[model samples]
Target: MLREKIFYKDELPVSVITANIVDYPFHFHDDMEIVYVLSGSIILKSGYYTYTLKQGDMFILNDRDMHSLERTDEDNMVMMLQMDLSYFERYYPDLRDQFFVVDMEEDKEENLSVLRNIMAEIMMEILQKGQGYEHKVIESTHNLISCLISDFCYVVNEDGKFQNETGGKTSKILAGRLNRIMDYMYENYERKLTLSEIAENEKLSIYYLSHIIKEATGLSFQDLLSYIRVEESERLLLESGKKIGAIAEEMGFSAVRYYIKHFEQWFGMHPLEYRKRYMGKSMTRESRAKYKRCTPMEIETAIHALTRGAFTETEDKLVLKPVIIDIGTAVGDDDNGQPKTAETSAKDPKEAGIFTIMERSVNDILAEPYHLLMDLGETVLAAGENYVITAEGTDTKDISRLSILVYNYDENVGRSLRKIHTENDLLRLVRHYDDEIEFLIRCNGFSGLYRIYRYRMDRENLAKKLTDSLNPEGGAGKRDMLIGRLTGAPTVTTNTYTSSDVLSVRTTFQGMGVELILVDRI
Candidate 1:
């Protein structure tokens, strides 16, 4: 009867926790549960299988599964998420019909990282409880569930065996006949379905179809049918006051004794006992007082630790075929000992209008100049006024062009608002901004008609994304969980400029995000 405690949150269908789990007596609920090992290790005994899960490892237990946890040699911090399928399935429909598992034989490091990032965010959301926190938490809960359904759901391979796989194979797994057979079993579990009937429909012999069902699901034909029937009977037993014989007959069991036999085999109890054992004892806000709830600092630590490498998405990169101009060859006045691009070329070189240019930041001269600046190669020079950190590319003296990248780091927002989606949250980030940068760079020695290039990494006001993603009612709570599951890139553009012996370029960039300024010879 031990629950992750959905009743505490009341109407909200998603419950989450980040805790130091010591041990839990064997218990299971109707909600799907996921265990993500954050620190140390955990030992879980679910049904017949016991697994030792280390850091970054995860395990999923389907609805009504009888499972328990045990501590290992090391101390462990686990993040757990439980979703009430009875509420979410009303929208997703097929959500509760599928089983989810992880087979350690397959390499799932990527999947594990993805699962951790989402789980970590969910922990922060609940603990912080910021404005629109409920909406964001539910949205992420849906994302976590969709990942399980699409990525980790059990699937029968071509050989009619359950295998854990990755890389977009859900369609292929479900399209196979074995999947169809499994679907058929769930669809008609309440009614009588014989192997011959299924075989006839598939145009295969009863014997062969029986073999496929066993090999595909790891359960014999009759046992698999009973598995589905007994699992389904839980609702009627708990929801309705129907007598054992009536419920049994309704669930396609010919007699009361047979139904009781299947119920005991699956849930370790008969129907009446299951109801009496769990139904009467319900609804505690805490999963268990002994299970230490994580502090805000702990959750923040976990978020950063998890997002350190694989969790934060790879920065979008752009490979450009730049016109490599050897700046060293630029013609210069012999007396001045500096490149004179303006006098060498027939056309008059462009003046320093861009340096004095206003609001080129929004125009994306080099995209949100702030963030784009940081994103450029590596830190070469950094300085004062509005906290500047500039990165550079290869040496232009030896190569074609000179680039200076600059970006901003706003520490005011903190971890909770790291990935801001709500208008209120974004305003908190935007309102604190001093999004202006004015600097003067006087080109030393060489100078002529040089081109000013803006490398743009497009960063739109993602506030518009909320309109397309979240509903007008501010997300329909768990209904959004029924809704289904990374981009931005860099670009280069050439603008006019003229260089002189003492080329003084004074530029003013205004706005937020990344910016990269590039200079190259004609």
Candidate 2:
């Protein structure tokens, strides 16, 4: 079926993703598609050819090929890259007439290997969101197009066999004509097409059109139309959620029996059987519900792990706020940890309370058919004593930005004495506190050049002096746990790391505070 796909971002002309694919029904669009097996296996049907692909294998679908995907096992993951070739219309108007095909039975591993590597790099750049990664993806997409045209697309003889490069210009002309007809077949397969209809549409005589159709595809007009219609109906069987009779009628078949016969002719099974074999298996309610969008950090980790058994390494400015439990604890003391003055403390209770004047807006309450429940996550442990030394890896929506918010919320008796000890007589400590809290960030999933910006937001300094204070810091090898230590006021700093698998940020947190940390690719 001609299911239109609008799948690009910012006019990039290429849409790519690494997904745990289970099923994709038979459908065709104008874009060329490439499917690479990252892990496990998948059974793909392209046109009349069915292939069971294993890891490290790739298949290209062109000729506006009608294709579908089915998982062979539960753990299958695939990289689907779709390129809108119409983008090249500016440079090469004949792109639509070019028929791209790969002969798996032939010896073409060299070109295929090159394609795999280029695609891997593209995936890395796209997922990593490194500096200039967009440009890199565009450039690599161009390379992929070039490779496809030069290696996979070639003129064939009248029998639909590949002709030699020596065929030259004549081969090009014939190849263009064939691909043109193939494209036409895809665009109009849903209709009751005939030699007369095709001839009328192409502005050519019936005799000439018939000869070329056979010459180009080694199939007569009627045979080609039947093949295409049967191929396209697969989408309806698996995806439309419609009845067989309705699907047959929609696919331009005169009757359900005829549609079933044609389907069996091409795929070696009844349409009902094919649908039963795959429909409930994937793209079901359960599968859709199980699908979860991975965070950018998790995605980077996945891409690296899938491509190699290893690690790798974007930037946007995002400030991370550290974990600040509450400021109400110090209400008895001033910003300098000094007790309130006698005059300030002697005011009437109602007149001197924090919110001496209060305002609340009342709105009409509306009843609804359904009620909603919420989870306000567990804030405190049953015990009164608790420490707050932690490193949280954060992500910014679809961007390749990574951040860590670290803080020292250690409220033990000792640090409370060494640090916020000024108000000892005014406020009493009542929580379990460690001498210092420290956590390790395992960054083995990234590598390469990274510009690390240290954003040190000292909550106490700002509260005490109301000054512009941000402690900037610095890097670590892969898997190294850099403990965060709390200390004096934070200072501004930036460090660039050129090598390392990114095992650790190798950082520290000691005192008390809350803020976010960010890491961008360079």
Candidate 3:
């Protein structure tokens, strides 16, 4: 029997398939799909396109595009990622009017290799189910989509200029209407809005407008209006010192109490407190340490006592400390120009001292450290005067226990410069732009979301900066400006091996993944 794949709105909106089958009946799904031939070969058909996919070949199938596996070898292994179209509709509203046109025979071998590697990684993460696997899957999916969009998908603009464009005029009309409605809501969120008024304005039936609004934004008319108003109020609170009651009235709230209630509900704090927290003071090393529930004295004392020879004179060199533990071995070189072994160094307390008695006491007060291998690049020489900064954590899923270790290597002295703890999982050093380096930090939330943190390296220390002010002229500003959150679900580029301006990241909210692109805004 021919089957139809059903997608539930509350689900993850993605499905992974890795199986070998022969002579499957034709079926259709509302979700778009990408099929990659992992090994062996398969013959498949989608709409009018028929092709034989060998190892490393792949193709895309749009929503409701009927396709079937005509043949497969006994050892054939294929992977397919299917995602609901509604998922993209929220971000890329024109997705419905587009169709992917990929010709493996015409594509460059390098492009094929890139796509193959991305799909393979996605399959590995999905099958392995490792920590942050959900995040990995979401990121890979966005990468795949981005690749298709950049290379293959032919999007139909309002003027209609692409071949194989689906939906044509109907898609354009619907998109235009939705965009208009959203624009109107955003422009007039401070005023009272009703479905009937919006419907009459857009010349849409109230019933159809209501349904489409929910389908397009996942929010009803009132809810979306409230969301916009609250967002505007937040901006006003941070940017101005107006009285709360006056601000509420200006934002179209009937009463100050009502605005206060909604503001608290949205931000988990009152407007005055929110304003004070963001607009009041700059976050110094001591204040950040306090925010993480640790003391600057404690971190400084432990590092100073344990490092033996390395020194830190000012708090400007220290960034954050979310975890601290003794690794039991000193991380420097000896006078003989050789790396000192933990066992050998134990013979001489000073030479072998990576941790002193006081440091151990502090470690006991803090937390036990975990041994993690630093993942330097493959091309990095083992023997060189290199200063490497890497991070380690006890658990991959928990960023709160992650520690950043600085290893200073020279012919005579090869030891750890310092170790600082952080509150998030450190993924990778994306790139260095201007005077700052951007790091992808995994948020310790269920949504599997990631945040981009900008840091400035000073000698042997790293100082965190607000993402907005990547190139601050002087002193640090408010704490909230230090990090910038990206929009959309996290995604990577097809050519992962090549350095590009756009970096892919995945962040989840309440078990769902949203892909985001980290760009050098500075």
For each of the candidates, give the backbone clash count.
Answer: 21, 30, 23
Q: Please say which candidate is ahead in TM-score: 1 or 3.
A: 1
* lDDT, each prediction: 0.54, 0.50, 0.44
**lDDT digits (tens) for residues 1-522 of candidate 1:** 233335428345787778888877566565788888877898887654567998777777776555677788788888777888876674356777676775444535655555666677667667766643554455455556655654576655555445545434333221112446666877987788898888988777888777755544445789878877876787777778889889899889988899999888866677788888666454232443357777768767766765542111111211122111112224456556765442233222122122222123322222245444445555433332222322243233333355554433223322323344454554444434545433334333323345566554323432222232333545555555334201223545544333322233223333334456666666
TM-score of model 3 vs. true structure: 0.36
- For residues 1-522, write the lDDT of model 3, one tens digit per residue: 112445432234567666554554445455677876655688876544457887667877666455677455444556667786776454346776666655676555554554555555555554555544554555555556555554555553534233333212222221112446666876887777778998899777887777655543445667656656776776677778899998888888888988888777655688898788877553221221111212334333332332222211101111112111112223478898886533234343323223331143322211111112123221111111221112233222332222222221222221211232221111111112112112222211111222333121222111122222244435545453333222111223211211111124332221101112222211
Badly placed stretches (over 4 Å) of model 1 are 1-15, 20-34, 45-50, 60-75, 82-115, 133-157, 161-183, 199-219, 234-242, 266-522
Q: Candidate 3 — which residues are off by over 4 angstroms?
A: 1-3, 6-11, 72-75, 156-502, 508-522
Query: Which stretches in model 2 have alpha-carbon errors above 4 Å?
Result: 1-4, 102-110, 163-179, 182-192, 195-522
Q: Each model's TM-score? A: 0.44, 0.42, 0.36
TM-score order of candidates, best first?
A: 1, 2, 3
Model 2 weakest 10-residue run by lDDT: 363-372
